[model samples]
Each structure stands twice: as C-alpha cells, then as structure tokens.
Target: MIKYCIMILAFIVTGTTSAFAAETAVLQDAVTQTNINYVWTILAAILVFFMQAGFALLEAGFSRSKNAVNIIMKNFMDVGAGGLVFFAVGFALMFGTTAGGWIGTDGFFLTGIEGQDQTWTWAFFIFQAVFAATAATIVSGAVAERTKFTGYLVFSILITGVIYPVFGSWAWGGLFNGSGWLEGLGFIDFAGSTVVHSVGGWAALAGALVVGPRVGKYDDQGNPVHIPGHSLPFAALGVFILWFGWFGFNAGSTTVGDTSIALIAMNTFLAAGAGATFSMIVTWFQFGKPDAPMTINGVLAGLVGITAGCANLSPGFAIITGAIAGIIVVYASEWLETFVDDPVGAIAVHGVCGAWGTLAAGLFDTTAGLFGTQGFDPSIIGVQLLGIAAAFLWTFTVSYILFNIIKSTVGLRVNGELEAKGLDLHEHDNRAYPEFVGSDEFIEGEV
Candidate 1:
C-alpha cells in the first residue's frame, strides 16, 4: 500500500508539471510579438510608399502642364531605380556591421541577415527603402522642367546608394551595432528630420544650383517672376495626401505596434494643424492674401518640423514647433528665392525646417530634453547643433560635387529649346495633356 501511494503521488506531480510546461509554451508562441511587429512595420512602409504618389502629383501640379509627364516619370523611376540601388549597396552601407562608428561594411546585396522570428530584415528594408527614395525625389522638384532625365537618374542612384546612406550610418548606425558616435554622445533624432528631409533639401539646393533656374524664372534685374502652377486643386490634393501619409512616417518610426503610436499620431495632427493655421495667418497678413502655395508648403513645413520629436514632444509643444515652422517656411522661402531658384520651396520646407526640427528635439524632448526629467542638460543642445552642422556640411559638399560631376559628364540641364518646349515632349515624347500639343496655348510667354 505504501509503495502504491508513493507511485500515485509521483504520477500526479509529473502530470501537473507537464501540463504547466505546455501552457507556458502556448503563451510564449502567442505573445512572441515579432510577427506582429513585422506586420505593423510593413503596413507603415506601404503608407510611406503612397507618399510617392503625393510627391508626383505635387511636383506635377506645381510645374507647367508641359512638364507634367516628365515629372511623373521621374518620380516613378526614382522609386524603382532607387529601391534597387539602395537594396544592392545602400542598405549594406547603412545597416551592416559598423567600422569605427562611421559606416557599415557588411551585408552587401543583402547576404548575411537571417533569423527565425526576427525575420524583420525584409520589412525594415522596405520601410527604409521608401525613405531613401524620398530623399532622392526631393531633388526632382528643385530641378524640375530643366533636368535631363538620364542625368537625374544617375543622381538618384548615387544619392540613395551612397551619399544619403553614409550620413544615415553616422547617426543611425546604432540600429545595427550600437556603435555610432553621435548616438554614443546621446544625440537623438527620433525620426529623421535631418536624416531624410534635410539631406534631400540640401541635395535639392545643390541640384538647383547646378541646373540653374527654369526659363523665365528670373528677370533681367534678377528679380524672381511669378510662375503659377497649372492646377491648385491638384496641389491641394497632393498636400492632403502627404498629410495622411505622414502619420505613418512619424508613428511608424517606432518600428512596433504599441500604445505610444496614439500619442505620436496626436502630436503629428496638432503640429500640422498649427502649421497650416499660422502660415495662413502670416501669409494673409503679409501678402494681403492667404497664399495657397505658401499655405500648402507651410503645412509641409510643420510636418517636417515635428517629425524629429514627434514621439518625445507634448501636444502643446508640437503645435508651437509646427506654428514656428509654418512661419519660418514663409521667410525662408522668400529669402532663398532671392538667390536660389527653388520652384517647389523644397529648400525651406525640408532643409532649413528639417534642421530646426532636429534641434527642436533637443529643446523639447520629454525624456532627455533640456527641460525634461533630467532637466537643464546643455550637452543635448550642443550635440543637436553638432548633428545639424554635420548633416548640412556633409550633404551639401558631397551633393555639390556629385551634381557638378553629372553636369560636366552627361550634362545636368537640357538645351534651352527643351526648356521652352517643355520636358514632356523632349524627354519622354509624351504629353500629360496631349490636346495642348503644338499649340501656343501652353507656351511659356503666352496666356
């Protein structure tokens, strides 16, 4: 009887242990969370990809009808060609193993990345690939209607595969190896104001410089001449599309599906609203009209401004940041137009505002901001300035050289005939509006 009782007790304990182990295994599989992250990140990437349509419509609408097809083609090609080049070389340079905290030296052609549940490598690639294309496409607008499609293609490949990725490695290398000097010094740029927008903005400035302004952009006395877009409705629609996509742009940077997404999304909304309101008010008071172009750009400026600290800033601060960005876009656009001929206001909205947003992260960050829990850390501000300076210098100098090279080698600008005739026919042999072909109705100097 004693032996039998001992055996029964052993069986009960063993059975109970086995049941608990099985339940724990089921829970672990259910809550692994990596698969969920992959899905969220991919969805965000899809939204960002939709922004390419926004950019195409925005640039096409802002430009002459004759150049609309060319603009659309360039935007389309950038996504295709830019993605391949970034996947082939840029991703490796950006996210591979680090060398001295400056660059990555592995994963070329995407060879070495592997995992079971952490199969996020591909999803991450798509997200970052869209971002890479965004930086390259910004140049299309600044040099629109005048650039050679072939030359522009080369520029796009180089920017995505080399210039942009190198700088991205400097600031974001930690994502791969925890080995970037800027990150080591606690320099935080939450979503890439400097990384994406400023880099694109500076490159756009360089391209504009190389290609020169569009025909009739400036008069004999060097005063800018107003060249209205073909359709304000299209431009407005593009702005709205961009606004919608930006929620993913900011919130998706979290790289996970979590509660913080709600806060980030709200902050994004507030800043964009503030930016639009303040810019409209400023333009209404200054120009005697609520300028539609400036107002649309102001909304973008606010989006770019708040991107850096969207996760770290409060709703009120986000509004202040965006409102200031809106106001700044007006002044910066006017100021840049005095010398540089940026047709789309890319310089002001992305480059200058991007830098400001990056620095604003230092001032308003809740966790490590100057006024955050740690309180009064001047070093964060210093680091932010350093990051901004580094971004401007690196992006500008390299891009200027690249543009010059492309200009001298394959030629950056089309012939003046092509400029007057419209790139749609000259470059693509296609017309966005075929009915106006061979008619003086769409000519540069005509009504």
Candidate 2:
C-alpha cells in the first residue's frame, strides 16, 4: 500500500510539472512574437521615412538648378509640417471611433492609449504619419518650381489633416480601432494603393491643373517644349532607394513575425523587375532611344501598382499587373504633358498605377479571381471600381477647391518674373548653385 501511494504521488507531480512547462513555453512564444512584430513595425516605418530622401533627390535632379533648393525644402517640410498635422488631426480622423461608418469621431492626439502597454500604438502611428506625409508630398512635386511656399504649406496642412484622413477612413479605418464603409463592403487595398498612392496622385492632378504650366513649358504654337532634368544619375539613384524601401512597405504590412512576409517580398521584387524591363522595351520601340525618364518612373509605377495586391496575388500575376502599369504610366505621362505641367510625373505614377493595383487585388485574389480554382466574383470587381471612383472624386474635387482657395487668398504661384529668374534666388533668398546661373534659353540650347 505504501509503495502504490508513492507511485501515485510521483505520477501526479510529474503530470502537473509537464503541463506547467507546456503552458510556460506557449506564453513565451507569444511574448517573443509580439516583440518581433513591434520591432518589424518600427523598422518599416523608418524605411518609409527614408523615402523622403528619395523624393528630394529625384525632384532636385529633375528641377532646374535655380529651383533645386526650393524642391529640397518642400520635401523636408512635407515631413516636418505634414507630420505634425497628421499627428494632431489626421490620426484621429483615420483611426478613431467610427461615425455611422463614414468617419472617425474622436481620439484626436492619440487620446485613449495612455499606459505602459501601448508601445505598438506609437509604432503604428509613426508608420501611418509617414504615409500621410507621403500623400501630401506628391502635390509638391506636381506643383514644383512655381508654387508659393506659404500657399503650398497651407495646402499640405489641409491634405494631411483633412482630405487624406477622411478618405483613408473610408478604406482603411479598421486597421486599428474603426470601421469604414468601403472595408465593410469587402474592399481590399492591402498596403494602400488606393488609400495612399491614388489619393496622392489625384490631388497632384488637381494641383497641376490649378497651378498651370511652367513659364517655358509651352510655345506660342501651343506645342509642348521638352525640358529635361539636369541629372539622370541622381533620379536613377532615387528610384533605387525607393525600390529598396518598398520591400518594407509591402511585406511589413503583415505586421506579424511569420512566413507570410516571404511571398509578399518576392511579389514586390518580380513586379518591379517586370515593370522596368517592359517599360524600357516600350520606350525603346516607340522613341528609338530608351526613354530614361519613363523607365525610371516605371520602377515607381510598378511599386505602386503591386502594393494593393502583393499580399494576395501570386507572383506571376504581380508581374502582369506591374508590366501593364509600366505601359500605362508612359502614356499617362505623355497625356498629362499636353495640358498639365507636372515636372516629376507624379500624377501618372501614383494615381493611375494605384487604381490599377487596387483593381488587380480583386482580380488576382484566389477566392475572387478567374485565374484561381474558384470562379471570379463580379461583386469584388464592382466594389473595387467603386472604391477607385470614390477616391478620385473625393480627393480631386476637395483638392481642387482647397488649392483654388489658397491660390486666391495667399497666391498659389510665384510671379512670372520670379519664376523666370528661378524661385531659389528670389523666394528663398538663396540659390542652389551660388556660382552658376540658369535661364530657360540656356537650358533649351544646352549652352
């Protein structure tokens, strides 16, 4: 009897210890995963923040030397002023309590999360703030060279604080703590092709239309003049930087430490490669010389086009989506040149490609695509179309009104004399190159 009791006690103790050990292991795994996710999110935000440098270099390289400093300043302000606006008003409107599924009603300035366990909230905020600045900055490139700094800053504040957040709420409000009508309708824009890129692109379109063309952009005969960037090498390097950062933009959207990120990163790589190759081929065939600018923009176009579908589509479909977007951006850039003076091709790359990407998300999704085992869902395509149209209408219409208000009140553009002399000298009280002076005639003749 004594031996049996001892054996029973030993068995119970061993079982209890084993169960406790298993539970402890699971708890440790959860904690480790959470830590990994937190780090990844913050790192991704840093990469996105670095994209501001890419924009600065790309815009400066494309601009005339006289306006180069102004370009750099505008890029910097997009992060500085724009980030503040997003923090104060944009975050609340985008991620707060839902107002009848249309907008956020409260939580401005990050009100609710105020303790030791909200580290992830801070990480998420920085990531989203950078994205808001990104959308606002696209307008700077579209309206570069002739825009009044004061007027541009005012528009930047409104875009990051009001226009972007309102539309973003409709598509991506549920990411943290709110619901949106579009997401409720089953809309899918994994990394914000429609929410971020398209919204920025359309606002850029409005700015280009409202701000008018550069002084020497069109001739007396109404024919457009060619004004090439001073340095293609700088622009190419900018593209390279943006490409490297995009891996974080897409794969990091998972916000989890797991194997799923591998496929998203692969899709991003293949899409960019295909986009560059096809764009180069098309330009070579059409222009007899490979159009370096179009090819350069093609890299961005592919990155924007795949953002919405990178998490959903197979790698092959991602390539197809990117190839088509590369073709679209080349034509779209040409089309905009006829009437609008967008110096950096921001409208085509972000707006048109963003729409294509959002649509591709629906078409390539396994549950809704013809390419998959299941038959395509028409409603999915319909929702995507609706979201695209809604984004354009909201961003363009609101942006047009906002730009005109600024134009009338504070002056949207620099005077003709200042524009001719270069904004760097007169507007900023400094010049990009103190020793070198540039004029339109000189730029035209390559003297």
Candidate 2's TM-score: 0.97
Best candidate according to lDDT: 2
Write one digit per residue (lDDT tens) for candidate 2, span 192-290: 899989999999999889989998899998888988876788888988988988888888888786899999999999888878888888999998999
Candidate 1's C-alpha lDDT? 0.87
What range of 10 consecutive residues in model 2 has the weakest lDDT sum?
A: 438-447
CA displacement after TM-score superposition, residue 216 of candidate 1 (Å): 1.1
Number of colliding residue pairs in model 2 = 0
What C-alpha lDDT do the candidate models reach, one value each?
0.87, 0.87
TM-score to native of every candidate shown: 0.93, 0.97
Error of 1 at 101 (Å): 0.6
With a 3 Å backbone cut-off (N, CA, C), the pairs that clash in candidate 1 are none
